[model samples]
Target chain A: MTDWDGRRWHDMGGQAAGPVPMESHDFALWEKRVDALMVLCGQKGLFTVDGLRRALEDMGEEAFETYSYYERWIAAVNQNLIEAGVYATEELAARMAEIAARGPTYGEAQDG
Target chain B: MPHDHPDHDHDHHDHDHDHDHGPFHHEGMSPSGHPYRHDNDSPLTYWQRMEIAVRELLIDKGRITAAEIANQIEAMDARSPTNGAAVVARAWTDPAFKARLLHDASAASREMGFDIGPLNLIAVENTADTHNLIVCTLCSCYPRNLLGLPPDWYKTRAYRTRAVREPRAVLREFGLDLPANTTVRVHDSTADMRYLVLPARPAGTDTLTERELAALVTRDSMIGTGLPLRP
Candidate 1:
């Protein structure tokens, strides 16, 4: 498991401490690797569409409907993976659970 | 069921008709119906009404001043280009700096004197054979520090809906068509994390200075819907 530092985590308004430096090539490689992991997690049902929707709601984002929510969730998950490092996978999973808990209680009308 | 009231003599002979003249027409109206007629006079959607109510409450409660919000908008309008141009110029001229930008965009932006905040998160991605597009599917969470205020079209629900679902078609509407095989990655920003696209440097103009290179980077290019300026 990645080292969990509660103190390092800040709310959205807090300042970012910057990303861990790596060469562009290395970073790209890592991104691909992480993307593969997310795809696997998604396929295995560890990250459901509902799960992603809930997560966005937890973050105070209300514009995401079902389909859009899933797509945006994947992007957010990938971002979290990159920023938190692979060791924080468990933490990411937990965050997803938190989101799912707050997922839309009622169906939303599809916007054209 | 037919009943005749009166009968009149009909003449078959007719004068020359003026066919060129047509009935007067307005821009949005059709001859058959009034385009502007509506059953209700409501001017706001549920979400729009909610947004207005919330903003009004915030003002009334003194949680946030209207002037402060306006100042933020003014600041965004002022500082957006600096961030976008700086990123593009650095990426074109310095490979090391580009690498840093790809790894962490907010930090790179800060180095250029732009503070990226008020977002829950920020992520930057790059592509060579592929192109990346940015949209806030949920709300307009933009990299205001880099690109200034997002264009009005970006805030429309149509753009938010179509950009993610059919990105290639959307880009085509914007007059940007990538090769059929070119990969298209759409990044959907939310209230949390904002995003900015790092467009590939265009060919030619190797002799141009950083400022000149920056000039070539347009706001649309950073959004991934348009290419860098040619000259």
Candidate 2:
């Protein structure tokens, strides 16, 4: 599906759509962390921004509708990192489980 | 479909957190006058968990450092519409710089000591006869290094689609009514190149200093959604 030559779901140019929503919000700490990782990994030559975009596109339209911007971004960043052999999915899953057990809130879960 | 997150609550809350983690302080607005997002107080989300895991894995592998990550975040925070405003103001005043900016935006921006960091930037000039609008039809490919992060609207599917389809109507919604004779050129930001709209200088601004002129340049003007503030 990533190879679809027709207008992909992510490709919204010239398509009929509704009014532009103008509300904006400041990035949360965790969201900023996700953004930093994306930039740092790209700077480190581990992956290109295009690779990140490709991963986001491959995640399909459902993600664009359901997830928040940074959520999708972290997913794409993780996907690219895994594809780049930076870490195994098993390692990621284990770490996630460990984090989840730490606390119910983000403050308690993150390392000091 | 457009995914919309509720605007972050501006009311300050007292959470049960004993101590702050990392560089984020949960008090007051950031230096930029924007309120900090309530991170520690929010419930741990699945995506946040993924972010923590990925960041930790990258750190464990010695691929990136915590300090480096902090520094990068700080750098991005430092970038805002002010940078683009300064550039627009400079172009408004200096003909030579404007020519250089219109010729090569990245170089001109770097010449001003703004490290745009490998972003292929293009400067589109708006004249009396023509106006320029920018949209990333494929994704939100904005000139972020210059203008900071794209606004919430810029990344929306409605904007992404209609900006190219009916830019005039879109601009009208933003309260900008272009004349019928003006040609609207919408720049679709692709994977490699980003665009900055060099909005036409407003009249009666000849006496204003570069800094003062910069104040007239709004972020939406640079994005071509709205005009520069009237002097």
Candidate 3:
């Protein structure tokens, strides 16, 4: 309690949020890919797990609140890649635009 | 408005501030001489799409392979609470093992064959007078190497915020009502370290096999947010 900043999102606990649910959850395809990509890149020395955590922490409050848990991981991965010069931000935008034009053909009907 | 969309989109206007072009001049963050578009016919964000683009680029660059990424994903998917379950069951059955686990969770887990990755994992024990809980307030810093990914709510703003402010209340909401004198200690997982709770063995289970006992240990119990099932 000497010099701790309790205002941040990660340090928050024990405040109050009603009864927690015990529901079972399954990961989506993109989420699973994000987790694996983060680990693979980490093993490749692209960045550390701590680096991703710090990147997630540095996000603006708006983005921080908006993205889900796995979505945040993807964002962190993207940030690291862009920072590492793996691709230019312009390059990413163009790729995204191209994909969007091609339409949402994401999941390959694995389960859904 | 983008707000009306479920994805909480902000559109190309947000990036408009950084570039000099007003209507359609371009050269902001993307540097393509054109303003960014929200014509994303899908539910993906700029970041999510970036995830795909970057991953594909990495694969194409020979830095990583699609098969490698797929294998990693498969390995992660194969992990569940069962790894934690077996560890807790062994600790419950053997005093020496329990001590070993409490002394060094990562090594003990490795002894059982589940690679604990590079992070430090400390196993907190729950006794008659004290209980333990783990949370990553800044992000969902969980014991992924041992427990796979965490639950959605565990990373929610509500749980993250409240779990620190009122641990007992949050636990009670999860139906864990500790005694007034019981000391509830919450472990906030940071970047370099993670935690798993070695919940006390339930009563009347001495006759169960290690496998059966292991089956009783749910993901939430190891996280200290739920108690093991009584078998």
Q: TM-score for all predictions?
A: 0.49, 0.94, 0.81
Candidate 2 per-residue lDDT over residues A1-112, each given as its tens digit: 5766687799879889888887677777787789889989988999999899999999999889989889999999998989889999999999999999998878888762
What lDDT does the true structure give each of the candidates? 0.51, 0.87, 0.73
Candidate 1 chain B weakest ten by summed lDDT: B1-10
TM-score of chain B of each: 0.68, 0.93, 0.80
Worst 10 residues of 3 chain B by lDDT: B16-25
lDDT of 2 by residue, B1-231 (tens): 355656466675554463434564445666457767666766788998998898889889999988888787778888899999999999999999999999999999999999988888999999989999999999899999988878788999899989999999999999999999999999999868999999999999989999999999999999999999988
Question: Which RMSD does model 1 reach against the true structure?
Answer: 21.2
Residue B54, model 1, lDDT: 29
Residue range with the least summed lDDT across 10 consecutive positions in model 1 chain A? A20-29
How well is each residue in A1-112 modelled by candidate 1, as lDDT tens digits?
A: 7765543211222223222111111011112222233333344444543444445445543333222222343455544433434324454454444433432210111110
The true-versus-predicted C-alpha distance at residue B126 of model 2, in Å, is 0.8
Q: Alpha carbon lDDT of residue B109, candidate 2?
A: 99
Candidate 2's C-alpha runs over 4 A off are A1-5, B14-27, B30-32
Q: Tell me the docking grade of candidate 3.
A: acceptable
Tens digit per residue, CA lDDT, model 3, B76-138: 756778888999999999889999999999999999999888879999999988899998876
